[model samples]
Target: MQKEAIYHRPKNNFAYAYDERTLHLRLKTKKDDTLSVTLIYGDPYDWKDNVWQYHKQKMLLTGSDDLFDYWTTSVEPPYRRMRYGFYLEDESESLVYTEKGFFTEQPLDTNDYFSFPFLNEIDVFKAPDWVKDTVWYQIFPERFANGDSSIDPKGVLPWGEYPPARDNFFGGDFQGVIDHLDHLTELGINGIYFTPIFKAKSNHKYDTIDYLEIDPQFGDKETFKQLIKACHERGIKVMLDAVFNHSGYYFEPFQDLLKNGEDSKYKDWFHVRSFPIETKPLPSYDTFAFEASMPKLNTENPEVKEYLLQVGKYWVEEFDIDGWRLDVANEIDHQFWRDFRRTVKQIKPELYILGEIWHDSMPWLQGDQFDAVMNYPMTSALLDHFAHETISVETMADRLTSLLHSYPDNVNEVAFNLLGSHDTPRMLTLANDRKDLVKLMYMLQFSFPGTPCIYYGDEIGMKGGADPGCRECMIWDKTEQDTELFDFLEELISLRKSHSAFGNSGSFHFVSAKDGVIQYKKETTTETLLFLINSSEVIQSVEDLSLSNETTSLFGNKIKPNTALTLEPFGYEIISL
Candidate 1:
């Protein structure tokens, strides 16, 4: 055995309390190096005479990536606390692995094994249970609809008249959202993630001037309350964006600091490098990516922490909002988020807290801070393989497998998975306007683990590039929209909701990935679902896929038992057995 390649650590992704009674454990070994792994575990105090009593259970080889094979199993420690170790073996030899070190045989003393001291109910990472069942729709309020054009900003353009720009507005508001709530409901979206509805100068609303007040352009707080009521009545949850990382130039504190130079009471609220703030050569103070209009907030300040915490609490306590999506969450200090989570969750214990982080976010997801982060890594992988064709199917599968193993299973369930958001190019545009490819991408996203999300207008094939380009006005005219793509996505959402194996309730595994074809499975205790996608231009076939007499196709054509499955270019199949 390759002892150096074997790895495990307690109290993180590798080992965690899956629930109050169950503990999930994982072990990693060099790719194909270990033929089998057995978990030896026992309650630390369950000993008699001079030896420790324990039970051994075999761990399943869940999946393997380029460099490692991941083994996983669950144990229900009777006493809710245990010491554990792994016995790994290859053809040549076997070894016992534990906290102390590798040994020729299983350690006699429990102290030599890894310890999960106890499984406290509070420490179990419990995100809102509702999140796993939700399919989110991300709406940029400024572009969704203009129900009441009377609230239009000064230079608001005619809706859909011109391509979106940083400075242009099209009079989208909460009333517009209220007007279009039916569209979301009809599309089966149960959660709406609105990007920054608070008062701000920019059309995107990331640069917040007022954290507590709704932007007049999006209507007043009363109208927003009505909108919330409308959404809740229709069984939809609302999640608003909170940009606590920075404030706009016109933000009262920032403006005051700019005016008073050195003697502003809010001086500690921001990171001002020098006395005279200058935005000419470079920002004299810290800002969001050198943009002079946005000054990064010093969240470490006690005053700033209290203010932001109240902002978090006010929405849930007052409006009964269901969730908060933290903007640029990775930039803030960890303690502030811990306090933020405690504050909002105390008001509504189940209120979802999502973070806008584009990379690995395990630190913030440890039951205390964020329930989930924007799954941009999965987004990038999907875009790379299905849309851009920059990576092969095998490479994409490897990347996804690694990502799934990066966090605890519970965290992955509520992960905010998205393909294109306000931050990236539309899925159709990224797929070079091939709606079939976009359909393939959607199939994988909806079938994969995590709560999937759809960017506004993506279901109808709205095409745009990044940033300002991605923020186009939603198409309201039925004649101009791609109704077929809409129907396809609607079906996907329906399947995700109606079928347990098709959603987060099932366990996911990559079955095959080769020659531009990818195959995977979502299996529950009673049912198994097989998904196949052909990313290549030419037709592809998979031989010898066994099917039962009772098998049925959820998508693609029905097939016979033990038949070879064939898919057209950019086609897919979802088989239920």
Candidate 2:
């Protein structure tokens, strides 16, 4: 028994309220060290005569990584209050673990057990229920499609003629998005996350000059209303970007400050360091990443707070936007976001608020702020295992397990999982243009829990490096696109939407991983899906799979029940039982 490897805590992911009535508990032990674990729990006050009343339920081995195995179970107390502890057994020893410490035998006193005094409904983390069912499609508007050449920005380059650069713009507009509604509908995405459509100076639109107006390069107010209406009619929810973290250098207020030193009426709107602001060798005032073109806002100011709060409310109340993907969310103050959530949800209670946090985001995800954040950690793990091949299957599994266990289950369900976006290299490019490796990457992404996003052009096998390269013009011509890859992705999306087990409605666990072959299972109440992937150059076979004869193949043709299966290099099979 590896006593030192056993771990559990009373808060956070280790112990959390799954809902108003149910509490989730987790325990970790050295990998494969524990044969079984039983959760012995009951209300601490439910004592009869001289004995403390309790019940014991066996815990399931939910997931494992290189160094640890995680066991979990859900329990409901009649009073929504309970004290609990674990009874673990290994091959050679058995022990009882409690909040205080390990015990050679089960303790008679309920005082020594871990406690959940009360399960308050208000404390449970509840994101929008609709978010888990969404399949997001990220669109960089300027390069998607030019529906209105009449509204083209001056000096716009011909679509798809030149490689994308920092300053170049193609005439992509709201009408363009409306024109391509069939593409998104056929591809089966329920959510459209536009990068930034608000009036801004740069092609990317992160440097916002006006928070309320739709960029003319895109369309007018009425045009945007029509676009949203069209999307809603097609069952697609619309999410716009909010760049409140900074303002463009040419913003009216910022320009006034630049022209009139400290005496300007808008002096307190930003973090101005000196009387005369300079954008030379170093910005005279604090900026976003030291870029003089983007000045950080003074979120703490009373007037600034009202202005931004109104901006946050205007879209949801007037334009009927379904969500807001906050830009640089972590850099802003927590109070601002909490208020932002209140303001937006007031207009639409189910509105999704996703943040652009690239690191641990528990602080902003306590159910009072953003509902979810862009899942960058999962992207890095997939890239390392599938694209870069820098880690073994076991190591990758371990990393993934750790990430999953780092958050409450509710948060995990709605996390914005993506392989590529405007901020990173395309998955195909990251895999050195290896189609097989890219398929494997998407397989894991769709199978894992969370809302998955498809970067524009990636569905058609687009390839490019980071930034300007990844932000290439979308390919619309049938002859120029990789239809085969598109077909493969379309099938995967269909499977995900059709099966409850393929998305957040199920629980995930690795069934087997050896050599270059990996197998995992996603199980729900009514269905089970088993995926076998071969990531190596050689063929692989599974001879001991215990699937029953009733199992049906959901993906590949050769897979059958209770039989050996063979996978060619980079091949995959999804079977339903």
Candidate 3:
């Protein structure tokens, strides 16, 4: 470590983990000087018999603007006491290491066997470790409600113009939700996932014009405080959509660089190229992965990193929010998250950070970064199984097997299992108002490994499809509400909440996959519950069912399966013992 070189995490002492097969290794210097970094994995304590020397591996290293990024083989060779280091390839060529009665004239190998010891503790946020069995709900605020109208915006932004249709304010602020906390409380959800309340342009505030400011459309700072207080009072924690991957076209940081061009004080704030666009359809820097509006920021830039990190810390310090739902998380630089995680935990150790990773998210969940992901996988499963009827029992079995194995055992605990969201249609329409299948999915949602997040309208049997359609207003009129569906959902939640073990203590095991009928059991040390579902159109005669004698069905219906438990079409049950 040099006195002049600057690094994002300059204190030097670091701790890292490789959660899946993907390995992203990075080292920061005090300054942006010409330097080089190498990664080696094996027994850092012993290079015994040359067997400890790991070689013949594929590696990648690239430098963009200033920061250097690279990856290496992620093979864990059952070795203990593994050490790695960074060596600056400057003219001076200094080697960095923990001092313990040792000296190096030149850059020393990170895994160079040493006798003396150097010790310091570093805590890496392990994901899926504690969240695999919990369920989460995702909510879009504007559509959710205008909890408080006193704070609604009276005017629009100076540069805002969207065909007069895209008004930023929609009366759905945090305080509005405070007016109706019981809407979610009745569902027995442990947390609420709100999209970016941070200042933005569009209705679905993905483009973070200002990370620090809460969108006026959603009320001001104080309103958020009340919302936080209200939710916390009711045992429901809150996590907001963290849109750090990109910024709105009008974001001050980006706008400044655009106006000042190369002479801008923050010239290196983005991935500048030789050709602003090389043509039209793609502007200079006004795109994400080269689109048109969602411009990607250079997270590798020091200034940019500092700004975003501060914003994340602001929420924790200002509102005591429980977690963050990072948007477009996969597209951003991995090192940035590593830094973000460290900075956030400094404010609150229990801050849960879930990424918007639609893929397997195995790598992200491997005890290193995110606590969970918006379970698009679970959503797709529910859609395919209940709607399209394409997912068969065996196919489901195979998918679940691979899903559990994809990440470590903890993933299912944290995955937010939503039947539908504002991004997609409500389950009512998706299920075509079948009531039966919807109830079945609700049972599965709560019964499954992850936390079940009920979209505000979805619980009351709201219906719609796709973006604008899915993002409909909440039906405040519970008078005409689908009481049957609502009651069934309550049963599922009550069953999980009443039994301490089922909350997260139980392990899921499939009992039988007969035709379209799927049966599974959730059991912890002190409790046992059985789930019986028939996804088929025909009634099922499930014989020798794998359930216990002591049964209390959810929806307050207690029944037994003596003469081959008969499932009326899409019948599903959450029976407890």
Candidate 4:
């Protein structure tokens, strides 16, 4: 066979794309390798509208051209922050940098951009404040309940085995989820954040074995359709977790590499060095360098970038999922995030994309990618005050004050406020099933600045911890059994629905905090609501809580703050005007 020059690391497909700093330019030239590769950067900030023409320079290879090493000509200085591509000298063919190999740049007219500073505000990643008070519920499918027992594993999974593996499958699924929609709606949850439903080997589905299909165990595509319709009917929105960080060990692309080694067509899809077995921990192999079961992807690969982008758009076009909750967001490269966010906005301008960040997310909240994230820090603060009581009234005030002042004003609107999720101990369980204390926690959750979210069963009181424990199913049996806690959650939820000024785009100010009594006010142009919670063990009273004129008394606000309105230990009050 005639010697062939190709970009396909799979060694079959000749297609090539440039990405990150390394340009994969291959050509079976009648000319020699002495030919120089020219790169130019004219558009300072423009990737779409402005212009760029290649300026020539000999492609140098004194050292390895790894993913992060970029190249350009002397005529055009490379812009550290920009949108540009590469061109091969012999072919005049240009390739754009992507998660996979490059694709030909389309006509400039094809690219479109809307007015700058999108959404209700300029912060691209920040969601509106209403997100926090609205209350979100995260559900892990398998282990929740086997709605269709027939689909359950033949007792072959870890949930049935001793020393269950975190990655084992137990068959909790969509139909089981369908059966619980009523429970979710009645509990007053406004958002449903589901773990990955896409086809994958592990029960958690973080490793996407197949991005295109739903896990058969989770039910077919239409079943989710019904679930979506039902959720929307009840005023609930659904968001699914997206694990773009990596895939399972047995994923098809990796399998291809195993079968063909360097000759595989998908060889470029992952990051592998020149040597086969020796490069096992290739740049893409050790994401956390913690495990070998999951292999990270070379998101800088142009084809890989396009492939994942297609997967994201496919779900939105096919199932109409309200948004995406990115799993292990920080693990991915910054270059990948920039492209990913660009593609997402091009597809749907308003789609909600929340990152799964634990510590703090203000950095990503800047104009570009995610809308919000799991409020792990906030959850910790709430639990500290109510669970161990290690937090004092003053300590609690300081924390709340920091949250209000630390983040940009707009971030409060879009944050995913959580007390508990499948990742953490259930809130009710954290409070040790103390209904009074639980009520106190939620009072702050709802009236505070950000969007609020309830764990699946926390509304009616669910309990568990990391992995199998945090993944417990909602208990319907309790519906008939415990009316006190159930009634309390129901009332709190109803209160959230009735108040708009307290929702998104509202403003929050700490009104007072003294003697284990904390109070705040949420206000808009037309409406205002006041909140008070006594996390103390003793009945506590406040001195003077200022109120707006002509305020009507409701649920917890019927009593006077100092004497008549003394809140007992773990008691909470929601006062609106």
Q: What is candidate 2's lDDT per residue for 14-124, written digit by digit as tens?
A: 888999999999999998899999999998888899899999999988888878889999989999998989999987889999988899999999889999889999889
What is the TM-score of each predicted model, taking all chains together? Answer: 0.99, 0.96, 0.74, 0.71
Clashes of 1: 0
Give lDDT: candidate 2, residue 544.
64
Worst 10 residues of 3 by lDDT: 6-15
For 146-173, candidate 3 gives per-residue lDDT tens digits of 6555665665322212221334445566
Where is model 4 poorest over a 10-residue stretch in terms of lDDT?
8-17
Sort the predicted structures by TM-score, highest score first.
1, 2, 3, 4
Off by over 4 Å in 2: 550-552, 560-562
For each candidate in the order shown, give its overall lDDT on alpha carbons.
0.92, 0.90, 0.65, 0.62
| Clashing residue pairs for model 2 | none
Q: Which has the greatest TM-score?
A: 1
What order do candidates take by lDDT, descending?
Answer: 1, 2, 3, 4
- Cα-based lDDT at residue 58, candidate 4: 46
RMSD of 3: 13.7
